[model samples]
Target: MPTALKLTTVQGNSLPIPGVESWHVTAKDPAMLVMTDFHWHSSVTVSENSTIDAALDHMKHTGVRCAFVIDGKMSAVVGMITAYDISGEKPVQHMRLTSTPRNEILVKDIMQKMADWHVANLKDIESATVAEVLKVFTDSDVTHIPVMEKNANNEQRLRGLLSFAKVKRLLVA
Candidate 1:
């Protein structure tokens, strides 16, 4: 026979939560300044078939400048869309080329395909400084870039994203 264990009454109604500490970051600091680690955060995503306006609206609502494009079942990332891609000349170019109205243009029409995306290895990013990552943003002339890592199966997967806008916000101007 097992003996009954004593239970203690709850002391407080509130539970402790993780605290966010603000830090002054320099270029020489860790590249965590701009990284949106998916391990700890959710990635904003949209469907490829969604309208450009819809995608832009979602991004705006989420206060994000970019979103990952997902497949039909929302299973995998198929591409990426940025506020610039929707608001820039790409929309107009697509409208003129395909004779499709602006409203009819879909995210897939303007989003950069995943296969064409330039990515950084997670290992490199792990040891990189803010300035080094910033150099990549400058050299690539891109506001965002995905960081990739290999799984136990040896297949590449998205680990996180680095955003120049985030970097500017965290580092001293």
Candidate 2:
């Protein structure tokens, strides 16, 4: 009061509160990270009968690590192909089982069979936290799960995908 009344001598007007040291969000943090295909997906696909070379080429062209395999002209997805499958000789191994040449291998050969593929429901995903999504990855062998959502007609259709790629990238970093 004496200093202020006599002269303009205020040292600091703001409280000594802590300021943000860094503003970065990582996957390991407990974030309410609800996500879907609409969040970060850019995609490409191949027919089940499409050649592995073609699938690989498609991946290369589109900068996608994976591609979905669709059934004959139907919008139904039959399987999926990933860079790991190609490099790990999975397609060649599948071809070997059927006595097919390596060059002739197709998406159907190495693709994760629809019966074996794991999937998630959009409704459940909507409320699931990032931790839960990470648990899904930790609890399953599948690297990705296609998400299905109910349409206006109440028919469930492919709407999104959750991949281990994000978890891998984050954890590794």
Give per-model TM-scores.
0.86, 0.71
lDDT of 2 by residue, 39-117 (tens): 3655578888888888888888976677888897757778878877877868667776888887898778788876777
Total backbone collisions for each predicted model: 0, 0
- Largest TM-score belongs to which candidate? 1
Task: Give stretches of model 2 more than 4 Å off.
Answer: 1-42, 170-173
Query: Can you give the lDDT of residue 141 in candidate 1?
Result: 67
Residue-level lDDT for 79 in candidate 2: 81
Instruction: Report the Cα lDDT for candidate 2.
Output: 0.72
Q: Residue-wise lDDT of candidate 1 within 1-173, one digit each (tens)?
A: 89899898978897666555565578999886568999888999999999999999999999899899998887999999999989999999999999999999999999999987988888888889999987888888688899899999999999899988878778874
lDDT computed for candidate 1: 0.89
- Identify the candidate with maximal lDDT: 1
Candidate 1, residue 149: Cα displacement in angstroms equals: 0.4
- Deviation from native of the Cα of residue 21 in model 1, angstroms: 7.2
Each model's C-alpha lDDT? 0.89, 0.72
